[model samples]
Target: MDFSLQQIWEHTGLFARFIIFTLGFMSMSSLIVIAERMVVFRKTRSDSRNFASKMGAILAKGDLSTAANTNLGKDVGHLGRVINSGLTAYRISPNDKDVAVESVARALERQAQREVQSMKRGLGVLATVGSTAPFVGLLGTTMGIVNAFQEMAKSGAGGLATISAGIAEALITTAFGLLVAIPAVMAYNFLQGWVDARSVDISESSNEFLDVVARNLTGGETRSQQQAG
Candidate 1:
């Protein structure tokens, strides 16, 4: 009995076919998530670089008043969003006081968390597929072998040859499962590492912005005190 893919699929029972279909869907879903995450990360990294290069000096100088009124071109990435939130908070603040820095810090933190969470979207699907695909494949194989045994018993067949087709069909599901799972796990790990690295970058940048805000507020207060005296 030939046990090629076509032969196995053609002779596979409904349960086995369904398992194969499920693995296929999982593979496709992982691929889509991997592609989407890659694109998002690529765009975000580029935008963040551009934003940092162009806006770092202006933002560090605490020129929030001018920056708030200016159009910060589109797609400044996660860092841009966090910076803009801080700027907005600063603009609304009444004065260069402890209150202003505290408020801006809160805003930056909130936006940073939001950006990290947003970037993590669709990663759950990859994790789920990576972790569970093998079990799903094993389920199909188990059922396939059981069905093969049942058929053998009914036919009174007592040789490997009798169940070879059924065994092959069952094993292919496991192969398919592993084939689907390995890449998904690898992709998940790689993307997760990228996300972690970006998260750290965002956190460090937010802290730097906070330092700038504190210094700007303190400097302004000192200038006012001297002028008033």
Candidate 2:
């Protein structure tokens, strides 16, 4: 069959429309996931930046009361949650130096893990869409080609133009699928990296905070004993 590329582009077929619709849905889903991830990453990144500053101020000032005050808030990031947990532990057992630090560190670890997981939410869907979209598009194209050949079989001497519509639809769908998949895959991977980095930051910050708390309490003990003597 004789088929010109121009003729294929000009015509729409069943395969083309099906592929177009499928690709459209996939693209829309990917966009939604991207938007969600962007919001999460932005918030997490901001939190990580502020956390160190706030923590440094708390350690330098040696004011547990003010530190507690500073750490208290609903909008604070993962680091905030960890710090707060530690602070809470200290408040609960101010005398038991080991227990206070351990309790808070353990609790914060759990909370940090949870927050990291939350940030990663919906990424799996994006990955799935990206990985599978191309094959789906190819399937549509294959079906279109099959239909075109069927038509050629019946027509005996069918020209390319005769099946041009089907073939075009197939190819267009495949292109659309790839277009949707690539960005989704890229976004998913990028977001994953951001999540990993933030998780590390939270862990490190929490550990440093515990160290500061231990040092502060030890210094306080030494000074108190000397004063009493």
Give lDDT per model, in order: 0.89, 0.77
Ten residues in sequence with the least summed lDDT for candidate 2: 1-10
lDDT for 149 in candidate 1 is: 95
- The true-structure Cα RMSD of candidate 1 reads 1.2
* Tens-place lDDT digits, model 1, residues 158-213: 89988888899899999999999999999999988988999999889989888888
lDDT of 2: 0.77
Candidate 1 residue 34 C-alpha distance from true site, Å: 0.9
RMSD of each: 1.2, 3.1
TM-scores of the models, in the order given:
0.96, 0.84
Can you write out model 2's per-residue Cα lDDT over 1-229, one digit (the tens) per residue? 3246566555657656667777889889889989977987788667756775766776777777578656445667767776787777777765766777677678778787888888888989898999999998898888878877888888887787777666766787688788989999899889889888888887887787777778877887898899999
Deviating ranges (above 4 Å) for candidate 2: 1-11, 220-229
